[model samples]
Target chain A: MARSQSQTVSLADVADAAGVSAQTVSRVVRGSDSVRPETRDKVRAAMDDLGYRPSFAGRSLKAGRYSSIGLVMLNITDTGNMLRLEGITSAAAAEDHAITLMEMAPGETLSLTEASRRMSALPVDGMIFNLNRMVPDFREFKPLPGLDTVIITMLEHPTCSTVDNDQMGCSEMIVSHLLEHGHANVHFISGPELSISGAQREEGYYEALASRGIPAPEVLRGDWTADSGYEAGARLAADPTCTAIYASNDAMAYGVAVAMHDAGKRIPEDVSLVGVDDSLGLFVPHNGLTTVRFDNRQVGLWAFRKVTGTHDMPRGRQHVLIPGTLVKRGTVAAPPSR
Target chain B: MARSQSQTVSLADVADAAGVSAQTVSRVVRGSDSVRPETRDKVRAAMDDLGYRPSFAGRSLKAGRYSSIGLVMLNITDTGNMLRLEGITSAAAAEDHAITLMEMAPGETLSLTEASRRMSALPVDGMIFNLNRMVPDFREFKPLPGLDTVIITMLEHPTCSTVDNDQMGCSEMIVSHLLEHGHANVHFISGPELSISGAQREEGYYEALASRGIPAPEVLRGDWTADSGYEAGARLAADPTCTAIYASNDAMAYGVAVAMHDAGKRIPEDVSLVGVDDSLGLFVPHNGLTTVRFDNRQVGLWAFRKVTGTHDMPRGRQHVLIPGTLVKRGTVAAPPSR
Candidate 1:
């Protein structure tokens, strides 16, 4: 049975039971400096007997700061995104700050007003927004008043603090390395159409080929999954002109590798491959797929520092890039002699 | 430059500018029915001019309930855990309850008192604890007073509402299916030792073996990673006696599959394989691996319903188990004739 209203413990009831005034009970509950130790203990015991629960909302209202930060993301299931979150959480822990994660539904975009309402309602000193995709409408990305926010995306906004990967540079390195291997006809399996990294990498591919006087080959778009890569690979395998393939990410590269294997083409023997963002390195050390590597953790750490630092001393907008490196595993080789 | 004290907005400033009492300003900020439309508009405009930001903490203290719910987890990187979380967030959204995610450091455990204190400090109506591992000390698992709590683990505790998958039943189905296919000996790749689901599944495996009058074979342990599974597979590949293997989860199974492939062992033709969970289905079609499938989404949805329902009704403890089904694919087959 539910407890009756009279049985519900209140500050006045605790005061009456402890033989103290309501103001004294309130001071005890709030842990005020003026309460005597003996009186505090007596009040606390009386409150415990009556099951008096102090509201965190009240205490946090008085404290004004929770020493916590909110990380708002569209999705956490993505490995790259999750790794970045791991970096942020680890860095936040080092700084004695806790993380409050808010995730959007799959493929759902929240309106600016809703986002503002949620951020305002959160008991966090600052917030970090990890928008994997570009906001179509500029106004939708506006910040909530009084909340310090940092954006983590591939794009650099003029009026916000951002920590992101050098995608254009990373893409250029991948394309240059592939071209240096004498692969004139390099087919590209790009990420989803709306992806900022995809567009940058595609531009890099075109720039490399154009600089070398090689015409841009057909580009197959993938939805950042291995299955999409495999489908693209199947289409490329039928074309002998596609002697090499550059996949946007490692998962897609793995899919392409599988498709090539099923099509009776051996890696580095019949077709060479390259990929970006080597999260696959975690599960498979001898994966033998060449790819670009970057410290996503550093990006996250930098973002945390920027958000928390700005929370203390509000600063002007700044943009920082965490660079990428080429990890040459055995997946790259000179184009097969045809 | 940081905003000065004079620039910092307060409720009193809004009240004074609007020519209303502090209580009226508070009501307007809280969107209370007591505030007339004209007064609310005046207060809101005054707040805008004075840049007064309403304190969610203060408003929540007066309301005695925060619309948000806390989801406390040990790790958010695990795919299964993340999928379950996806289920929870989706369900919570439908019910208009926002979620605040609290993740413990990777592989870190907090004491009961610490966990209680953290939950108490959060402005959440209730909390869901998704502890993947079983607590060694019973006292450590005790629920916090005055906070409605739900657990998402296989253990059936007396004081908590729990939503869990039937691990033992799922394991039994996998073992029974493999044995029915005329495999005389089935090696097992078990999950981490401390995992509650892992322990339950191992027990089911032994139960199936004993029921068939077959002695239990050597059980290889993995830390629930594909890399660990690869190491285990490498060890088992050398043992010709090992014909069939049941991996604890799909990622580990995928690793074993890769190891066997590298070792020139044909799946089903040389060694039959089975895995638990079908997260791989997310990426691949026609995966050719036989396994058990359960709606982790359902477990998450059920947990959210239980938590929110209890929040309203303030009910007693309830235990729920979502069952699993065996998905027949090509991976399981009769052992190759010597």
Candidate 2:
């Protein structure tokens, strides 16, 4: 049978694209770290472009332990939780770690406590804990005690082995993306005003717009759903001068997209849009959603490795402040006439 | 500080509904084997009506090791895989066993192989092996040496501790539901026909119609996607007699709903609908899917318990079969002009 075009993009093509010899591409693709950055970037870029995604099993066999790690998104009720989880799973899978997921009843208080106890009773040595929705103030300190746990989400449980979006950093990135598109005015549609995610990301947005000497356009509220996003979009769409809007997550961004779509305003033409956590399932790539891609899968893998012996993290408070990369998929274009 | 509503529905409600004392309701709820038939039915009816669901975690601590047996589903893409997985997960969780999930890349054959190897390596004694998208010819079996592996799908891996759904049972259930609602002419939307889920469920639809001496409904193919269901629904909706449709999975049913919604028809009032697997997160539960709720979690827990226990199976060929319960919700009603 003929191989998929994605699967058939060969080692030779990857090597050629990386400007390295074929065997060298093979070594790098095999995940050998000795390759020079110039070469590594070439190979990685080539692999990413051609979608030369290595098989997890092949990688597992070669690496002894699969480059794949496990990620259990603590709950599902929170849309942000799923988005961040999507980030973790897709990023980790892209980085060649097969992500293993388990959804807990987010509302159940003791579920996580019990899940941690049971996780210790099972295999899969390392795991990134996506305690997204059920962030208990005192609960974080319990420390799935014996297990190596890396916490994701800003609501730091009592313990500190965690990785969170540079809330401030992300807001800055979106604002900067808007600024690059020549929009002096950029508004932030923050998540539920009470949430830690809302506060941190909002702070970043305010700082970014303020530092640039451009008045922050306006503060609008959203609850992280597409509906809330539509409301935010409707508000912004009503404004004659509003040019760029950054939603807290993709659902909101989708709502914004729908609202924009309804208003007959072409994206990046009438107004620019930016969303956090490149969520895969809900919105289509066909929508051309300009998003800040957080490598959640990588975050998950990195956290898992930290918990297990694969990746070393020095003791004391440590974190992986994974930066959000702006995905310029044609959503951000020049703003309309001022 | 109050317990969650799902966890704390009382014996009083059960008693009130059954028109009996709370003590009698409590005894019946406990599944005491010696209850009077009339009293038991009254109590059972009351429990079901009041949503007086059982609490597995509270009582099953008496069972020794792994009272909470998790069925780790390595595959996550296919709706069938998820349904069977949900069946096992729901069953196990209901039976007081925890369900640990693991979703692997279907694209990575090696990862899948490695995942099976690792799943076998896990401490879980028994499990429902749902071959989501992978079809097997029962070739060289990867010996899952010790684990009581319940091969759920038709993919013949080396099997014991297996549970094949009563496909005919499900089909009869749906056909009966449609017939009860006065629809003699029903149409079918099946899953990937090569897979067991599609075949079994579709078979159920066919057998019921045939057994009733009615002509078999015209069948359409769907890959279990809302879009495919949309395509199928659009085609079906155009027909004036497309008064009844059976989608193979809840996702496809959702698609059918959207297509019907777009086609300007009320569900059940215009076209009575039935689907399999009351899937979670595919869409909001506004359309309350009338599906074959295969209590997968119980299956997972039971399978896990069976595998991990001292239960003796006569070495050669063995498997377990769990029944799928008919979950009648808002999807199906009498066909138009009935």
User: lDDT at A327 for candidate 1?
Assistant: 90
For residues B53-129, write the lDDT of model 2, one tens digit per residue. Answer: 33222222222233433244434434444444444444444454444444454465533345555553232334445
Regions of model 2 farther than 4 Å from truth: A1-73, A76-128, A134-149, A154-161, A164-295, A309-318, A323-338, B1-72, B77-130, B134-147, B154-159, B163-184, B237-241, B253-294, B308-338
Chain A TM-score for candidate 1 is: 0.77
Docking class of 1: acceptable
Model 2 local distance difference test score: 0.63
lDDT of 2 by residue, A83-107 (tens): 4544554444444444444545434
Q: What is the lDDT of residue A83 in candidate 2?
A: 46
**Candidate 2, B1: how far from true, in Å?**
36
DockQ computed for model 2 against the true two-chain complex using alpha carbons: 0.05
In order, how many clashes per candidate?
A: 0, 32
Leading candidate by TM-score: 1
| DockQ metric for all predictions | 0.39, 0.05
